[model samples]
Target: MLNPKWESIIRFKCPDGEVHYGEPTADLKSARVWTGLDVWSLQPTDTTRHVAEILAPYEPTTIIGIGCNYKGHAHETGIPLPNHPIIFRKLPSSITSPTSLVELHGGDVDYENELCFITSQPARNVLQDNALNYILGFTVGNDISSRYWQRKDTSGGQACYAKSFDGFCPIGPKIVSAKALQNFQSLRITTRRDGEVVQNSNTSDMLFGVRQLMAFLTRGTTLPAGTLVLTGTPPGVGSYQTPPRFIKAGEVLECEIEGIGKIQTEFTEVNSKAA
Candidate 1:
């Protein structure tokens, strides 16, 4: 278990263009720099710096996405709830800054607001009850998707291809340790598209809780330290909406969790030749 004395941590750019890890203040405007090299054990020095820019918290060893794990999401899509967790892999290349732009490939892009958790240690065959002990911390992620490639008819039902594009997964603002959240359940999650609320739900809507997913994922599958798992998104994704609302180029998407704060992302169309 990562019993971090610090409540939160953030990787940010200093005024001099150097990058360092520090503890984010309440307003997230400034951070107290850490002198220690090891992030798991941070010793906050007296030095403090203004957050010139907030970067993605960690470059994960692996990015795992859970599908149809929310009851309302399942019901909306008319897909049956899984007896087992439905999981997919997202390449590390998809990782991007929490405040960065999500490139528009060909429109039909969808938004999924989810709770993301990172593992503290190698885990294989971990039991459900002890799963929490393996978690390092929690943060929210916006699992951006390209709908055309995600459909069964086009991509043979594989989600990785559509979801692995550059900047497809923009996660952070900062990371809040699991010890601080105490309970993952009952936390309110909200998503806004162009300043209008579209997804509003709670962590309670999850068909599989954090413990269940951690145990199931580590069943004979070793997840190395820093593995990021995006627990399923709640109901009200753009794909499952009536008439299916897709993202437009130059639009903004924001996903926020109750305690950990929010991440705002904008989308821009990328030309195939230039991409």
Candidate 2:
């Protein structure tokens, strides 16, 4: 297992146009990406640059999203708590930068703010007691979806299809090491739409905590290094609203996780005529 003592690790482009990994400065306005180093052997150089030069940490090999892992979220969706963890895969092609514009394909677009973690090593049939050992760090992610395709387009519901659109998964800003957080279960997660708080809840509300989810997911499966896992969203998703509120073009969505960081994304309409 790869564990680092750094407060946060970031992947960014320097003024010289080279990407590197390093910890963020105190105020988080800038970062210093490591030189000639990998996650397992990170060494920061004497260089700090503005946050604008940073990119979306790294390109993950696999992206997994947990469904209805929170009780309140399941209630809001009128779905019963799942006996076992529900997992869905998001294509690597769907990933975009932390501050990039999400092209909204005409449909019921929705936002799900979630706590995401990345693996530091390959894990197969990991036990709950040793699950955290495999995690490198945690970050915030927005699981953008199309409700129409998620629930109505297929015979049942095609979650992967509905959420695998281009630029659907926006994660980052930075990855806070697991060692930096005292209690992973007690952190607060909040989501905002147009500066209005739409979702507010704590990580303690998760039906299956991080440990259980990790152990269950790794059963008979190998989660390779740099694999990202989204822990699911809290209540207050737009699809659950009384009037069913979906994200509109030009709207800004922000996801913040206590002890981690915040990532904001803007929604833009895709011109079908140009497609």
TM-scores of the candidates are 0.96, 0.94
Choose the strongest candidate by TM-score.
1
Candidate 2, residues 1-275, lDDT tens digits: the string is 47775678877776678777878876666776566556667766777677656568778869999999999999988888999999999999888778888888638999999999899899999999988889998888899998888986452588998898988998888888888875889999999999999999999999999999899989999989889999999999999999999999889999999888788999988967864
Candidate 1 lDDT over 119-144, as tens digits, reads 98888999988987899999989989
lDDT of 1 at 54: 96
Candidate 2, residue 91: CA error in Å? 0.1
